[model samples]
Target: MTLLESIKEPQDLRTLSPPEVGELAAEIRTFLVRAVTRTGGHLGPNLGVVELTIALHRVFDSPVDHILWDTGHQSYVHKLLTGRQDFSGLRGKGGLSGYPSRAESAHDVIENSHASTVLGWADGLAKADEVLGRRRHLVAVIGDGALTGGMAWEALNNIAAAGNRPLIIVVNDNERSYAPTIGGLAEHLATLRTTDGYERFLTWGKGVLQQTPVIGQPLYGSLHGAKKGFKDTFAPQGMFEDLGLKYLGPVDGHDTAAVESALHRAKRFHGPVLVHCITEKGRGCLPALADDADRFHTVGRMNPLTCEPLVVPAAASWTSVFGDEMAEIGAERPDVVAITAAMLQPVGLTRFAEEFPDRIWDVGIAEQHAAVSAAGLATGGLHPVVAVYATFLNRAFDQVLMDVALHGCGVTFVLDRAGVTGVDGPSHNGVWDMSVLQVVPGLRIAAPRDADRLREELREAVDVDDAPTVIRFPKEPVGEPIPAVGTIGGMDVLHRAPDPDVLLVAVGALAPLCLQTADLLAGAGIRCTVVDPRWVKPLDEQLPVLAAQHGLVAVVEDNSRAGGVGWAVGQALRDAGVDVPLRSFGVPERFLAHAGRGDVLAEIGLTPVEIAGRVSAVLERRAAAGERIRPKENGA
Candidate 1:
């Protein structure tokens, strides 16, 4: 068996010699490339962290000494070392999670895959350890890209002040998160990387000072106490030192021995310490290493040998539709600017950035800053489009409400992956945006049904000069255009049966599903009229009136059923005293597990068959109740 196969748990790693450990790293990389190619996960990041993860497991005993991964995309090696090596179903329904999961192992902590959160978790864990009088260490492995987040700095400030806490902050300097990390922190890290003055001083000072007999011990002690000041004069990693934390290395992250050595020193220190390790993203794989574009950070299922996608390409996705339109919008309005939270390519802003380089801004992983800055940009006489994943937008909600919505700034929030982003698991799903944003008064939300509407509504969203507007779409490829047979107010009527008994309200990409559902109902001799309310937030005034005509109204959306379009429509109908029986269909409140989007939808009863059956059952119940209530003509 190979060294990798021999390591069933972290403890198994201890049995291996130094040479075997190095061999283990090589084997793990090869295994990851082969396994991940089949399932398609965060390949480049995992490739970069093989040695780092091995060193971490070797240095710290997990479940006892907490080893937390920031962002968690780089935790595949960590998973392997912790005896969770099965990668056949990675990111799939019954498979291993792409990020750390407490359910998977006792070693995994903090399942939230959002960036820059590990430091805060580390600080809290360290505080608990100190309070409990435990000697167990807290090590947070955070990427340099994560350091760009403001929360990382906030945690650093708190960690620094707690000088008695033994915490090891491992900065995995890969120089990229999605795209090259932006902002001042990235620049500071770049500056710190170039200077080897600290390492050189430690090596030279130890040898020369030890040579002097009796004075050597005392002099070295004095110099060690004054090491921060001496190091500040040379390496200038004083950023951490100034904050009352010990700064260790610019260690080569790919070198298992070097990383372990740095980790060892940090673990020995009494107080908080920061170890900066430099590693190339996509270290082992030639294709990944050669990739200049975000280092192939996240990949789809691909050929193991060539890295070419196995699946046939579909039509333009919702993101691509937005990107193409944003470029045209940029050309028409020079004042239109775009902002991304360090995900230019993923969110489809790459084309816009290429077309109008000066108009685009990548604000690192700071969603809060992106919203607030967009508000600032709007006030400065420019229309700002803040493009981000719907899940990530949750971070900026307060900013969007306080800075943009309250102040009445014209900022368009283009939310890609707005609903049921299946494979990434619960944390990555964008289903909660509609429910959460319900409280933001005056914030208009548009859920486009097709690529045509996505383009049209995006223009409308940006045109609003006073309030914040949101345009949200799903992760799936843009479906064939569902044409409106008629329009009532802002709602597009997609299907209408003569003598309609049911009014079907379709939200966003669920239009096709609603159309299919209407067909099923019609096949059963139940007349159904389907309408797509392109804008979901503000219930179209005509909706209540239209609902009154039908015996029952069913609202379908990809968002949560709690406070989504269905709830809004029901409330509107109630206030208008329409008294129509209403049924809401959407994702349940519980967190959905990793699965295919179609499977999840079917499981949640969002399928046309399920929806039709439910509607038929409801109608049958209503008809039976009607017969019991009404006096039969000659029944006496």
Candidate 2:
């Protein structure tokens, strides 16, 4: 068996020789390229961390050590080393998850896929251990890009002042988070990155001085004590050391021996410590290294040798449509500026950035800062558009409300992956945006059904210059534009059945699903009308009026059932004194498991079959009374 297959647990790595560790790292990289390419998972991040992970496992005993991975995308190697080598179905049904899973192993802690949270987790774990009088080691492995987040600094401030709290923070400095690290933190880390020469000098000094007997030992001790002076002269990692935590490294992350030695030193320290390691992302893979864009950060199923995609999307993605339209918008409106939380390309702002270089801001991974800064830009006389993933925007809700909405700043938030993003698991899903943002007073929200509505509503969102506006769309491809049959007081009538008993309210990407649901309900002898309310919040004034004509009204959205569009529409009906029997269909109030989008929808009863059956059952129950609730003849 190869070195990789010979071990089933992290303990197996402890006994490996230097040559063996090198061989194992090579084997892990080869295995990763082969396995991850077959199943389409994070290729570059895992490739970058093979040696680092091996060194971590070897230098510290896991499970007992409480080693944590920030963002967790680079934990695939950790999984393999911890005995989860079966990667055949990664990110698929009943398969290994893309990130760390607590259910999968005792070795994994903190299943967070969001960036810059590992330090906080480590701090908490260290405090708990101290309170309980336990002697467990806590190691938080964070990416260099993640350090840009304010939360990380907050945790660092606490971790630094914890006085004798034994915590080790490993900054996995490969210098990229989907894109190159941004902001002042990236610049600071770059300065520290040039201090590799200091480490080399110290290594040479320790070897030469320690050989001179008693005086040599004293001299070496004196030299090591003056290490901070050397660091200050060579670099300014004093930012970390001044915070009160011991700082080590500028170690080569690819050099397993160097990393293990640094980790061993960190383990011996009495207080919290930081070890900075320099590594290359996509280290072993030629194609991954050659490709500058994200270093193949996340890859689809592909041929490992040729690096060719096995499957290609048949249509343009919603992200690309938004990107293209934003370029046109930028050209037309010179005052319109764009902002994203370090995800320039992912959130469909690439074209806007390329077209208007000075007008775009990559605000690192700080969404809260992005919102507040957008507010500032708006107050300064320019219309700012903040584009981010719907899930990530949750972090900046307070800023959006207090800074933007309260001050009447005209900042538009474009949320990509706005609903039920499947396969990446619960943390990545964008289902909570509608429910959470429902409480943001005066913040108008638009849910576009297709490419046409997306472009139209996006323009409309940017036009509002007095209050915060949001445009949310899903991760799926742009289908053929669904033209409205007619318009009813700001809502689009997709299908209208004569003398309808039920009105189906479609939101955003679920418009097509509502149309299909209408077809099924017709077969069941239930006449229906389907309408798409493009703007969900401050819903069309005619919605309650229309509800008064139907025996039953159902609001369907690809968001959480709790506090979602259904709840908003129900409140509208109640206030209008319509008293219509309302049914709300959406994602259940639970964290959905990873699966295909269609599969998850079916599981959550969002499909046409499920809705029709439930609606039919409700109608049958009311029919037993020889009447539908508050029935209106001819929908009047």
Question: Over 4 Å off in model 1, which ranges?
Answer: 205-230, 627-636
40-88 per-residue lDDT for model 1 (tens digits): 8999999998888988988889878889999998899999998987899
The C-alpha TM-scores of every prediction are 0.96, 0.96
The 10-residue segment of model 2 with minimum total lDDT is: 627-636
Q: Please give the clash total of every predicted structure, in order.
A: 0, 0
List clashing residue pairs in candidate 1: none
Report the C-alpha lDDT of model 2 over 92-211, residue by residue, as the tens digit. Answer: 878899999998999988899999888989889888988899997889999998998989999999988876999999999988898999888898899988777877789999999999
